[model samples]
Target: MLFDKIARPAMYRLAYHDPEVVHERTVRLLGRVAPALGPVSRVYRTDDPVTVLGLRFPNRVGLAAGMDKNGLALKAWPALGFGFVEVGTVTRHAQPGNPKPRLFSLPGSDGVINRMGFNNDGAEALARRLAAHGKPGVPLGISIGKSKVTPLDEAVEDYRFSLRALHPYADYFAINVSSPNTPGLRALQDKAALAELLAELGRTSAELGGSTPLLVKVAPDLTEEALAELVEVCLGHGVAGIIATNTTLSREGIAPADAHLAAEIGGLSGRPLAARSLEVVKFVHECTEGKLPIIGVGGILGPDDARRMLDAGASLVQLYTGFALHGPGLVRRVSRGIAGRPC
Candidate 1:
């Protein structure tokens, strides 16, 4: 209610600019303000113990990645109340991402479009912080992607390097073969490439031991046939979880009058994504014949949307654009809603 009445009006004024800059400023501002909230922040924390993919999640609401790729504000998040935080789409090596205006907001439509191209200080930088900080009160999931400059054929090695580097710090490792912004990244999800990538990661993770869960984040725009094949691969590779989606390349649901410069390029997120993500989750659930569990993503802004995904059969849910627009209060609302629903 506070965001609907107070914050939404304030954010509308800045919706015209580039998204990455807006994101950086928002994180810094939240870090400063989060520390002062006191017990108000605790409303987002839930003590329920959930063991998924071999890790004990304090709760099911995870802060989706691309929010803190470098883990810069690691210490501040737990205090602000996130059940878990998935940081980074950190690449194998650091490189400046797509030039400028890579991020955009479509406030009139309650969505955002980002072509961030996986910009980060790379896996090593994130691993150092995670190793130093250990893990959060909730489990920490690290999302790793292939570097932009890395050629398509070498995708496996690129993801492997990041996996080995982040192994110790991650409670679960998310193989981000999804994300539309990276040129050939999504191609890796194709049968031949995806099979090799997951097979190799599975072998290496097993050698490392310790049982950290492995999840594959996928795109909602995929064809039904493609999704079926992906689910088959996931089951074969021992995937412990499926992050039902990443932001979408589809622009169908957003109100045309309000779509921004980002509307021209990049993946769409927020309310526009809700229905499609629910469909994807339902599809994955059905294909697995109710076997593989999913962590639903896309267009979630409040408890109702969160509940919709759960009703569609997601085991857990995550937010990126919703959390950005509504502040920590959104997490609190969603977390409280999740806790109330009997699992």
Candidate 2:
């Protein structure tokens, strides 16, 4: 209530000037104070432990990828009550992503449009930071993507490079091929291409003794047939689970007041994404007959959205835009709500 009433309103005003600036400053501040605040933050932690992909999570709610691309605020997430944190979309090479004005806020629709293009300090840098700071209390999943300069055909090796660099730091890996910002990135989701990529990563996982679980993130925009094929490819390569879905290219639910920003080319997330993401989660769960675990993400904004995803077959749910909009209190509220519910 405090956040929605006060902090959120202040953030909205700041967002009008430059959302990313406010975001960067906030993350840095949290990173600096996380250690001192750790003890107090634990009050929000829920005891509803659940295991997925052979790892135990303190709760079902997690901070999704893209929030901490370089893992700068690793320790802060657990302190803030997140069950897990998926960091990065880091690539083999560090590069400046799409130019400024790349991130936009659509307050009218309670959504965010970003074409960040996987900006990060690269896999090796994140690995070093994790090594220096130590892992957070909760499980940490590293999301790896192809470098923008890397061609589609070489995406296998590009992702392989990041996986190899960060393998020791990640409890699990989220292979990100669904981001709409990178040119030709989503094309890697095609059946044959996805198969080849997963096969190569599968080989690397085997070579590493297969300790870390692998999960593929899919786009909500995929056709039903395409989604089915992607699932088959993931299962074929011994993937541990799937994260459905990533931001959508479609602009179906933008509010009229925010219609002016609708044409911005990027993935749409938050409330606008709830229906499509839930639909994808249900479809994947039903298609796999519940054999495969799922980490549902996209438009989750509160406890109810989290419950719907779990009931739809997601073993866990992640928060991105919601966290940005509602502040840390949302994590506690959602965690407590889920903890109070029957499993």
Give the winner by TM-score: 2
TM-score of 2: 0.98
Regions more than 4 Å wrong, model 1: 29-38, 260-263
Q: How many residue pairs clash (N, CA or C atoms closer than 3 angstroms) in each of the candidate models, in the order given?
A: 2, 0
lDDT of 2 at 12: 80
Which tens-of-lDDT digit does each residue in 159-183 have in candidate 2?
9999999988899999999999999
- Candidates in order, TM-scores: namely 0.93, 0.98
lDDT of 1 by residue, 1-343 (tens): 7866887667656656545656787677765665575666566566655766666677778889989888877656766567788889899999778878777777778888888889899988888877775665567889999998899999899988999999988888888988999898899889989999999999889888848788999999899999999999999988987998998988878887665444468888899889999999989988887677788988888888888888888988888898887777787778777775654
lDDT of each: 0.82, 0.91
Worst 10 residues of 1 by lDDT: 12-21
